[model samples]
Target chain A: MTEFIPPGTRFHALPSPFPCKRGGALHGARVAYETWGALDADAGNAILIVTGLSPDAHAAANEANPAPGWWEAMIGPGKPIDTDRWFVVCVNSLGSCKGSTGPASINPASGELYRLDFPELSIEDGARAAVDVVRALGVEQLACVIGNSMGGMTALAVLLLHPGIARSHINISGSAQALPFSIAIRSLQREAIRLDPRWNGGHYDNEAYPESGMRMARKLGVITYRSALEWDGRFGRVRLDSDQADDDPFGLEFQVESYLEGHARRFVRFFDPNCYLYLSRSMDWFDLAEYGDGDVLAGLASIRVDKALAIGANTDILFPVQQQQQVADGLRAGGADARFIGLESPQGHDAFLVDFERFGPAVRGFLDEL
Target chain B: MTEFIPPGTRFHALPSPFPCKRGGALHGARVAYETWGALDADAGNAILIVTGLSPDAHAAANEANPAPGWWEAMIGPGKPIDTDRWFVVCVNSLGSCKGSTGPASINPASGELYRLDFPELSIEDGARAAVDVVRALGVEQLACVIGNSMGGMTALAVLLLHPGIARSHINISGSAQALPFSIAIRSLQREAIRLDPRWNGGHYDNEAYPESGMRMARKLGVITYRSALEWDGRFGRVRLDSDQADDDPFGLEFQVESYLEGHARRFVRFFDPNCYLYLSRSMDWFDLAEYGDGDVLAGLASIRVDKALAIGANTDILFPVQQQQQVADGLRAGGADARFIGLESPQGHDAFLVDFERFGPAVRGFLDEL
Candidate 1:
């Protein structure tokens, strides 16, 4: 369960002795990526797409791997990303278990899972790795860089740390910094995994996985991913039929509870707990304010781009709509034509993933002009 | 850690074979309560206070116990409850581990902890037990019955099931029925506990207690008790000193994380895990809609009361302000002069407990006229 690499995934060998931002280095390290369409001779129509915590490099169905990808609806020939016109490259985050060099990956020197031996991961580190993938693909400058959720933070870092990497940017449900409420949620999720007896200090194997802890963490994440209004409209007070005569009095009673159980079980079975821990902590540690003399806006302003569009759902609580507004303002302060769009979708932080009607047109409009 | 009873707590032995609403009966069960001030002749000046999932019967310092109670600020000689004018009784919830008959209490027949053997507890059961204690105190009818958090649910149940039990009512941060969002949150809390291996199907002793599980549950509760606004104002991403050079990369980094850990550790040591599960489930199971054809407003309208006051903070996410407005509206539909007051306190669900400046006057303003 440590790594879940999809077929047809390509790899970029990072420079030998790749140094981590917080310290430590890895030898013979590599990052996974996948691209759709051919890069133009001038490499002016290339776009790099970074993702949230879980997704692999395979974002959309491709000829090499016909299976529908995580964002199949949003990333196809005629989809929002429009592979027919633009060469789109998606990199699996460096700290993710999805075919990336992370805590779940085997250390080349020791031939053992990095696990606790992995250096502390930060959003900046993943940003650097994504840049390496883009450069190796022979693209000196990307037409646009699109990032969502955690990827949004990494994309901003990519632009801030390595200026002129992309001509334009699209941030969906992103933030300039992690807020207290979000930190609390992520901190609790990490504790759930760490406290599980089966975690055993990150030594659990596939047969005896930290299923319970992972389930709890994923359940919490799912709850926050959507808005309460959506929950009320979808589940309401509907009771599960199984709740009527269940022997375990504390078992699932509502349809919502059953939904969470099903969703969590499906996710935790494939995702590695140690990798999840490393990535979750990295997000909590990410604050753009560090680059701005203790000001988030200044940090955001430091990232330069020719044009940008920041879109978010009004119902997003984890990365609230206000943060997107801030992202636009900060980039605009840096002289970029950063337009902000707050969609009236009830999907909360995950609106960009499901509410394509609003996000698609906004992303398409921004890229079409370029 | 099964039960933590404060000294000087008094008990009222229930009628043999006291029945529970869900099913089963207690052979020689009793409820714990503590009174402040003296009961006036005819018991016309009596007031009963029902609390949330936690808290003991001692609502304020009394002659028998000089120590401060959880609601020490809100109830005293010159305070909102004003013990000098009205005799106050606070009953520890029946399903609680605090000096009351619950999963932690020993069964009369088997002389073993009730644990899972305890009948399914509903809000109606705790309401019935509170009413019995009120009757035993020589109060034919209470002048006012105040309920806060879970207590608010019990208070409404008291008025609904036992029609003349109390003349007036006050519901603070309570709900008419459990919302899907709240249910999801509680469901995760319960799963965190049940997943702990040390819980051992509810058979673990104090030495093998589910401390990790309890810690997780308490931390989740603490996060929701206050609002994001308050967290931002109070902690604001402030880091703890210990987090600076901590060897554990996943350990506490923010002040908010430290606050939760310290708060959770203190609570898990005293609160019994089984009692927590029972009480938490009871709150989720309660729905006044059961009395009114699946319509929460109709269910609330069935309750009879002379006067009422519903108070809540605008920031409350667990029990949002809209629920209080509904309580007021439903009680008004039943012909009671129910006044709804939404306070501008950042404390959220726990505003009634901490923001005394706003709540004290609201409670006193309603009571002084009565």
Candidate 2:
């Protein structure tokens, strides 16, 4: 289980230029990614697993860490994203912190962290950066591009912005247009961060971080990530402690409170607050139909991918099944080979992460057919 | 629109001793409330409107303020509550700040705000306080007792704890037991206040108030008060000052953000951080079944109220319609005259506040029949 990655595995860094939709260019932007398995001479065997919001290039099994990768259980040697077959590449998105050129990366001219000065990013730029990373690796074509949530939106954007880059795509729990409800929720979280006095307009340097604000933001995320039914079933009105008198003391009172705190603490450590702000704003700004004259089907028609798989969770209130239906319907009307699956899972939008028994097989079947 | 209270209109403060379920006594406990119309000489024409969480005694029509009371539109002269005929008493529950004995009120023994030292409260205690208030008012019986949300729960508790108090009951958007999901949301809000450094374990006196914490709590409340669809339809992803360049150095970027700030600011001014914590915990600890050998229906059966009306919101994910149905079923099984109405409103659990046209008539019709 703790086997190490073969020394033959190669890592690459590609400095790419992304033409942002905001009428500005982000130059000297490099995407760092890793490659496993072997790239066929024609590079047609390449498969890309676009990372989710905050995930980096490390999408494959890493023996040194022993702990499985974010989706390790599904992307290992014998897993759905079989490393033994496809030449897999997972690139850190453009405006991310994991070895990618993001807010934390030094500004070329200012010689300081970009901080608030980082160019505003869009999903188009994120997809464009992935294309550059792939091109730098000398891959002319991809077998399939798979992503979840934000990554899913980026995968679709790639097909629309750069046609024929991938033969097939998998979109999990994502929408073609940013839902107003989703935007509202994200806006509240961003406001929470901005309201923190310590944020200092995103200029807080090596000082006390806006931990409280970040915690609130994560708390909001926790609410959206899972279903209300799940929370009730798991923690309900149960007291955090055995002593009824001390159950709701001046501190953490419920099991769910402690659970949310743990989530916030871990997220604050691994996630850059500035990057979170930028990425969330990018998602909020995403509107495929707007780019295509208010026609969602027309926007999807621009994609020339041969095959696509759109998956949704039944209990996903954030990105509900209707959103996925729109994506599938648009792709079908665009004359693209598309299939949609609405998985019945009580876990809500996060079912993709928790319901691996179903998701694993679906991914495996999609990849095998492709 | 602007008028003074008529010459004959009168107001009174009713104080009563409420016994706690956990033993001992909450002696100085009082239910501060006001009344409109006139009670029959036999004191049988009284209608009790239990105020919701955080609401004060100002639940009925008041001419001095010019603006309508919380339920003024429905409970005025010749209105649904028919103040022209029945005496309506709106009592501020115990552990509340609006003219009632709460954390802000001086502890009889300490001569200071109870603060964190305030004894834990439950919905039963709130109902008991209502009973005391009613008894102290020299009212032998209630024609009808109506409540919404927390108040609804309190009304049900009153029926169970003190039989023959109200001949008829109307519970809107409340549950016999606080669901786990609701408790989880409340726990997060409470944690937000406790985590604030200024909270000082709820002992923060007149010093820097936990404004940030309270703001976060209000933001959390806003999330549950309305549906995601409602927020998106109302605010969407529209920016506050879209014309302003990202380089603009000041102000919120999105309208939703500004909306949330305004809500937070208003909530912080009127709501006490500690009182919010106490009231929220009271709701979380509410479990009628817990007091009745873990039998919720049996507990409801213990109530001997005559006619009962349980109204629920279709979009209320917090206290879903199922909870209301359960209450109605319990009442019906107990041989009580009960009816359930599931109102169609997309305003979530707070629909009772905004959808006055439908709710107003339904409430009025019920009261008229009583």
Candidate 3:
């Protein structure tokens, strides 16, 4: 798996004994990444795009695969962060189940799946891995680093830990730390997976997977990602008319139930349950204030970035707009040129994914300034 | 079970062949009820109190058990809905496990647990049963009927389906119909119960209960019942210090996680999983407009009540204040004296349970006018 890098993707091994934040070390740890466009001679035109929880390295379509990537709309030839003008590199997170080495990875020493033996992950660790990938590409510094959700926290981690590596940082719908509401939501998601008897202490037989738990967790994720207003607009009280009035009342009788079930079923097939558990825990444990010596402002003020942008959605409940405003305030107090933009969309925490028209201009203008 | 009627509690069998809204009939359906105070000479001083998804008929401390009930703060000698001046009747919902004939009950014909064989339930069915209990107490008409959450929906159903049974109705955090957002949430809750392997298609062995699923469902419910603002104020980012730093990253590490776990564990002991599934589906399918041929205003117009109160919490996300305003508007359009009052509190959908100071006076005032 490590020897043959795909045409559009590359793999790089981190330095020996990469120390994880939660007191674990990995040997021969590798990162999978994809790049679009060309790097300048100075290598300063590179733009690193960090992803949220589930996205992989395939950020956009390429000659090798015509299938659109997760951020296909925003990373094309003529889109925001246009490939024609900048070299865009997207790396799969360290504890992700995609091409990256995560909980599903094999332990070199034991010749078994890491599974629960995998080190506890944190946003800082993901940030460190991304920086290693950037350095391996012979890029001394990045022109900008863009992050969405979990990626947003990782970008902030990069600014605090490896300052001066990225001249500009864009944090979208991420917070300084996980709030109680977000923590509670994630706690239930993990419990759903752990409580499944099929899980068997994270060593379940592959044939009988914990699909039920994963599906339930994904259903919850999809619900929280969008606002109630968005659900009302997309699917009102319309019943699933296929079921007659005589059908079981507990069956999926609403259109929203079918919609949630459809998405959750698809998610269970591709995502690894253990990776989800690990990554979600990592997000909850990440506290930028911990790095800043117990003060949120001190932690944010410690960032040495030159320019930054904090974007939030007005209807986002997961990471409310108030947190985004705090990010901009902290960045400004830290002496960085930071601009705050709040998008008015019912898309909620998912505004960045669907509201490209509003987000595209903001990214384009910010990049133009740099 | 019917032989012993606790001091203040009684059981009333509904009229033979009780017809359910969703095309089903119960041959010997019974509702358990508790009453506070005595009826007047004319037998008109009755206040029927309907309950939320949980909670039993024990709404307040009575002669038998001195222990304060769920709403002990707001219902007593001189509290709101004062027992000294008016008769108060509290009934367990039609599909509940607390003394009411529900899924856990043995079918008269089958001689076994009704389980999934129980008829589908609706707000109208619960409302009709409560009215029957009130009539069994020899009260021809009720002075007021008050409901909270699902109980709120039942209150509306009482107004629409059985007009003139109550002269006044108080709806707290209830909507005319379930929204897609709420439907989606309830669907997931039911899925949690049914997906559990122990559920065994709603026929699990009595010894091996589907506690995990029920616990997970209750955890989700407790989280949604409160607001993010309230969670932030109550739990914040406090870590579970009981666990060492080396504790499993996936373990319950936040104060909110512990709180939810404690509540969920207690809930699993008292609430039956199948009853939870059936009632949640009922709430999702209930539509007041369906009672009036799909016209919400017409449904409200069908109510013969003289006065109404629609109460909502400002921070409630499940049933927003906007929906309560619509309730007031629809009732007013029907020529009823309806008042819409939005309580300012972080309690969210559960404000009625805790904000007695704010909710108490409103209920008292509404009944006084009637």
Candidate 4:
């Protein structure tokens, strides 16, 4: 069973023998998504959300799921997204483990798990998979396309590949292309998993899982996800109790280390390591500059939409606020009424998920005006 | 045998069973050092240089070891730290594997490698060991004590523990205490090293060394040592040739990733993993606040020095510029003529090592005034 899925989940059958952007094809491919609220009579009130690296299609609670979601605070009746007025569709990334056709899924031809045999994936492929869901739902044009983190890149890809698919866009903590620093981080994460002997060339079973590698990768991600200011504010020179320290000299001693350990342990079992490697590598390979003859801004300018808002945190070292500014500038250059908002949230790249007090109104204000 | 030691290296034997800051003691412990120029009859021109984690006693070439040193550009006949004008002594940090008593050193008591059995190390222990070397060298007081990176913390400890041991101080990219951000980075690095099966509870022999762990740790260190801005400028969206990409799905693709790989490969075998773990943890455990009633500033105020200069790079995320500023302000609060200088170098924490054009003048100007 997929980890953390909504009961309302629906699968959209992708084109048979679907080809990936980076060469290679998947047979019997599909995408998973969940909806909140009903599409208007004319299918004019639909909004689509693409998530960050780790999230699934479940963005908020619904009568079918009856469970709070990754973005529960932002997407509910009368919430900032306002499910009452706007019908929302959230799709799980194509290369993700949560209810999506990724390396963990069975290869229809072989009747075995895809694992490393899965085709090389790109951000464009995820965007294409998402586009299929929207087209299949009978939504002629989306009211808005909202993307967070990696999803922000996917949103731009959607707007660029299919011009009239989305009326507007909201890019949260996203970039036009991957930065070298980001690429290095993802590379290290992939290395952590690969170096683990238990990974066994991506052939590990649950009993022989690469727990350490996944844990290290998760810890590294958690470290970059939040800002140093937040770490200091949350756990400044705070040592763990002696009982928790254990005898191992290298064991968790600080509160921040323990927090990371807990986070990594919780995530290691839930997410498949091979799936993580593929999704992470896809982000590293995403380059909008490829579309505009080595100009990221030009590539973004090619994305046509009615309006766009690129929002990011000031402390975001991963995607960085500069990228958001670039996204807005390029969208504006392309004739869309685009704007960039940088919040002084100390939470870094994950601010969108946790700093609701600041992000909520900005999202609501943008949607209310639209 | 020690990995890399200069022919000019000299050993200073400490008192038998020397006590550590936290508990336990080391027997038959010795400090390694190298000298440049001759000490004046009055010993008034003596300068002591304490290094960061990886550097050895060989800061510059001498007659016995004329090979170019790690800081070849900075400390020479008429360079910024002019050996022609001052008698300089560079000491390898105590817990490091560079010709110093560390986890890699044999325990005289048991006639076995200290390894995991080595006593817990602290920055203060390194500081005390350096003081012993200075005292044995017949210098009642040093004209200046210069510390870089982790050395910055050691230099502060030198002044705090043994007041008036040095007349002036130079703290480069150093912090009075470890920040939660720094602790998290180091904690992750240690985890990388310890998780490797080859580590084998720190029982690794030369043949079965934890090369992967060390490589991963070194890569993480390199990532933090340099700035993201530098990475973007140096390898922005640059891909390796197809031949170099190889067939591995998660293999190195970007120039930055290759650079890190080459660097990690070069460093992994050079430094012992156990020694790396101990020294890294020492920095994380160091806190000036321990000396000052739960206040870092108060702790700095307690250290008595005639003058101090805390210089750092603006882009240094590891030992951030704010930390150097705090060091200066704290020293000033303690009645020292301390000042802070934040350089506009793009090299991050390693600015002192690479951006000699910028750092040379500042260091020269400070010592010239003295």
TM-score top scorer: 4
Q: In candidate 2, which residue ranges exceed 4 Å CA deviation?
A: A1-19, A23-27, A62-66, A203-207, A243-248, A295-298, B1-19, B22-29, B63-66, B203-207, B241-251
DockQ of candidate 2 against the true complex: 0.47
1 against 3, candidate with superior DockQ: 3
**Which residue pairs show backbone clashes in model 3?**
none
Q: What is the interface RMSD of each candidate, in Å?
A: 0.7, 2.5, 0.7, 0.7
TM-score, ranked from best to worst: 4, 1, 3, 2
TM score of chain A per candidate: 0.98, 0.92, 0.96, 0.98
- Residue B27, model 3, lDDT: 82
Q: In order, what lDDT does every prediction score? A: 0.90, 0.76, 0.85, 0.91
lDDT of 3 by residue, B254-349 (tens): 889889988997887678888888788888877777756887666776777888899989999888888888888888888889889999989899
Off by over 4 Å in 1: A243-246, B243-246
Better TM-score candidate (1, 4) = 4
Residue A86, model 2, lDDT: 89
Lowest-sum lDDT 10-residue window in model 2 chain A: A1-10
- Interface DockQ of each model: 0.83, 0.47, 0.87, 0.87
Better of 3 and 4 by TM-score: 4
Q: What share of the true interface contacts does each candidate keep?
A: 0.87, 0.47, 0.91, 0.79
Model 3 chain B weakest lDDT span, ten residues long = B1-10
TM-score of 4: 0.99
- In model 3, what lDDT does residue B317 have? 88
What are the per-residue Cα lDDT tens digits for candidate 4 across A154-269? 99998988889988999999999998989998899999999999999989988999999999899999988999999888999999999888587789899989999899988999
